[model samples]
Target: MSTQDPQPESTGSIRRVESSTAASGSSVEETPPSTETTESSSRQSLFAEEELSVLRLRWDEVQSGFVDDPRECVQKADGLVSDVVDRLTTGFSEARSRLEEQWARGEEGSTEDLRLALKRYREFFQRLLAL
Candidate 1:
């Protein structure tokens, strides 16, 4: 009997994978993300550049202190993680609140805008799940 792996399937604009079985070996093909997807992903940064820089600096300090004080380093790392999570939660909450306010004011967003918002949410949710 012969067995072969399932072929990769294309899904949306983010990923496209193709595979073929040949006499000698199998080959896989990857499709680059579309320009729109690339631009949107770049714009989806959760933190501003300055905020990210500060977080990276704090992380470096925590990592460097680990050899001298492991426990303190762990505690500091935990606190930093908590702060990042809180900031992300707050950002999402504020965005949702703004959308709710618009709806309450009878200001409906365009269908395309709403679709894009939902797509972003789904992508974020998927990334969280992956982590």
Candidate 2:
């Protein structure tokens, strides 16, 4: 009796691994381990590195000022969060507009490209839900 190694099947961003035991005619299906770092790096960021650094600096200032004026610190934090949300909303809108333009111009991207875009949207939606 021989056991075969699991074979990988990819469907868009998702992958499935399947293995079967010939003796008992049993099969198992599993999802492969996620490469979070690689995948996250590949996905587009809503903010630039410089923007993120500036935001971090501002956050640090707000935190440091909390000891002096707690109410003002809370207000600043609320404003910062609002700005971040606005920026994120604008970023997503811009991306969607670009894609829509391409489609309208008869330049619809490849199936894989569209699939990746949808995957990114799904990931963003999941994150928003978590919040």
Candidate 3:
């Protein structure tokens, strides 16, 4: 099996959140691994360390702009957050694929994968709010 699972289609969940943020933020911008979304909840595809590092760096770039460009910072933050949500969504799907493959092979599927994804989701939620 391929180590890389194909990324899924962008169903409207991210857009639904983006639309809500638009109503609130671009006017007011904000982001999800919504527990309400079964796909996000079903499995954990943890970010590889390199991916997490890049995200952290992107976040730093957004945050560092606050003094000179608060509005731009907000916009950039919105973009960065949406990117992270997309990554998480991909991660969840990859984990689900791995779990299913493991199951078929008679190996244990780690709930810890899902657990970590949930943790990242929670962090994403809290960070979006804090921004």
In the range 2-111, model 1's lDDT, one tens digit per residue, is 01111111110222111122222222213443556544543444444455556677778887899999999999988877766666666566667878998999999666
Specify the poorest-scoring 10-residue window by lDDT in model 3.
Answer: 12-21
lDDT per residue, candidate 2, 1-131, as tens digits? 00111111111111211112222322221233255633443343444445556667777788789999999999998887776666666655666787899999999776645645665566566445534
Q: Go through the candidates in order and give the clash count of each.
A: 0, 0, 2
Model 3, span 1-131: residue lDDT tens: 12232122233122111111112222111234354443442332244445545556667788889999999999998887676667656655665676688889998645544444344455545544643
Alpha-carbon deviation at 109 in model 1, angstroms: 1.9
- For every candidate, C-alpha RMSD to the true structure in Å: 14.9, 14.5, 15.9
In model 1, state the lDDT of residue 93. 69
The true-versus-predicted C-alpha distance at residue 45 of model 1, in Å, is 3.4
Give the candidates in order of TM-score, highest first.
1, 2, 3
Query: What lDDT would candidate 2 get against the real structure?
Result: 0.52
Write down the worst ten-residue block by lDDT for model 1.
1-10
Measured with C-alpha atoms, the lDDT of residue 52 in candidate 3 is 47
